[model samples]
Target: MIDSGESAVSDSILFVTHSPQRSGAESVMLDLAAECHRRGMSVSVACPVGPLSESFPPWAVHVEIPHLGRDHGRRTRAGAAWGMARSMVVAARTLRAHRGTAIVANSAHTLPALRLAGVRSVAWLVHDHLVSRKTRVFIGAGRPLLHHVVAVSPTTASALDGLVDHVAVGRLGVDIPDDAPTGALPTGPLRAGTLSVLTPWKGVDVFLEAVARLDDATAVVAGEAFPGDVGYAAQLRERAGHPDLAGRVTFPGRVRAADALAQWTVHVSASIAPEAGPLTAMEAMAAGVPVVATDHGNPRNLLADRRGVLVPPGDPVALADAMSSIAADPHGTAAMVRRAYAHVAEHHDRRETVPALLDLLLGTTSSSAPAAPADAVAAPSRGGGGSR
Candidate 1:
């Protein structure tokens, strides 16, 4: 949507991502974009054509871009380099065509595009504390088109401590219910579950192993690998097929967001790697499900209160103990659920946090209070270094 004769009131925000997959990071981006649309700010998303793109609403503009392969083999790396360069130029050209549209680089893959755009885009970092050397260099260089870098987790913010000029923790927003039924637990056997992308680092194996140790609870896992990650998913299937896990572990491939969490008695997040911003965990807490997450990454920060329990990362025995403890104490679990609902409402509610995010982007200029223009109060103004 363009500014018709300079009378447009809405600000335009263009979101860029590497893949359209519904991963944790992408979910956060989509949530913010959807919230922006709700707030009457014109929103659009640019990503590779896939299932994840379908999640975007009909009202927002959709831009399909090339998929740059990863840095694995030499051939793939070369191809990715070429594709990344081309994609960056294409993204810059697309933005150049549409004036006054702020850019939000949803992934590190969009770094090249932000560099080319010249200090007009914000780097939305959701990937963990491990910032790649190349990405760090790209961010370290004071590119004119690049805006300040904002991360979804404090761990991520701390990891990138000195590399960037500006860093802020853009907390992921969750929708908390006005009221929740306390002491009303799900019927039948307790279910221990986790929502994650089907990668080894996500610790699905650990979750399955933990489930195998317990008898009273069924294990429900939700996730699927990317298009070409068949081997990885197949290995996970092999793990689920173990004799101890027979009829106990169920991998419902890529169910709707929060579907697994809502049904389960106690939600689990067993990521071995340092998590950035976990949308499923946030959604589960918002839904009043008691969470048992790894004591690492964003979960460690979110589960500061007695809302949920935490275990050592990658330890199946510890996870099993946590799950067992929660299952045994029904009253305690119910109380924890209430605390979780309150915690999410106080920190992550959308009615408050969504506008705060918009302010973060709009206030990225040299001036502390970069006010939206009179006509574009519905959206952000076309100020310098306005985030994408």
Candidate 2:
């Protein structure tokens, strides 16, 4: 398929990611890789050995390196840099062996490393809204080699204004299985819950504080702390053990969004900080569960017709009232949930969004290409804290 003169790039793609976790970003990367290979392009992924590495199929090549994680806040700057430097050295050697037409960096962690290795035509997929001064300098230095950037949300895209030369929006997609298990409406005490990684910024604490106020509603919190934030989850458990929260609040710990949504009467997204589009929230909407999300960041981008309830971020009083309201007006909420479910099906389906993501990666979309729908800008919430 290639001419002799054009030897460097030949429809091969190399995907680089930092850690092999079940996070939303990793899910998108694996889904994208599978889609690319299905389209007849050669694809391979290079990541550290961890739980998620096993999820890659036999059709895709997997290259393992030292295990990777986020920079610990308590670690000294020099120490963090040194550890990353060692990982970079090994990753570079692996990259050199797997030549491709374009190299894709799944997160900011891999972009600089690939840049330092002199990899050509590198594409950076912005999963989170990263705009640190240090990150800016590193990306700026590597700007010459960059092909473009694919941000998951408009907020993320807007954040990249001065940081990168070319920017594209990639919305997150959800695959609704025909055989997806259906959940029944609750008949007893109002059971409300949320599925999210337990972190301070994720605002599970806010969810808990609000749940403490609703005497008629029982709450379930699913999701464990990620690698870097175990202490925060421990604190949540300690708080859940408080006498006031006693028998009302439960921590189920790291269940799939589908299972959690099916178990609860209402699904909630109570993040305090801005989040990219969260797949859990999208999946919940797809499953016909009523949603209550904070009115900041990517959630604003998803619920266009006010399908889900929105509350002020960090306000436990407002969040509690929203959850209680959903539990009270089942018939009214069911009518609203139908509209929300239809909105998700029409827009956020993976079948439609994956090709759009590949188009951005392959430089296939042109100026005359159809304008982006609002969903692409708030497509998938690939934020580090929301899923996984």
Model number with the top TM-score: 2
Q: What tens-digit string does per-residue lDDT give for candidate 1 at 1-388?
A: 2221222233777777876576767766777787678767788887777787887778878887765435333366667677667766876565455445766767666666655555344535445567677665544442344454566657776666555545666666677778764745688887887878888778888888898888767888787887566677888789878888777888888786556666888888898887875767778888878889999877777787677899999899999999888878999888888877777776777666566655554443223232321111221222333222
**Model 1 Cα RMSD, Å?**
6.7
TM match of model 2 to true structure: 0.87
Cα deviation of 111 in candidate 1 (Å)?
1.9
Clashing pairs in 1: 20-52, 103-388, 104-388, 118-144, 118-145, 119-144, 119-145, 119-146, 120-145
- Lowest summed lDDT across 10 adjacent residues in model 1 is found at 373-382
User: Candidate 2's residue-wise lDDT over 163-226, tens digit each?
Assistant: 5655778787797656432334667877888888787888999988998898777889887777
Model 1 earns a TM-score of 0.83
C-alpha positional error of residue 89 in candidate 2 after TM-score superposition, expressed in Å: 3.0
For model 2, give the 10-residue run with minimal summed lDDT. 379-388
Question: TM-score for all predictions?
Answer: 0.83, 0.87
- Top candidate (lDDT): 2
| Candidate 2: residue pairs that collide | 171-379, 172-379, 172-380, 223-254, 277-381, 278-381
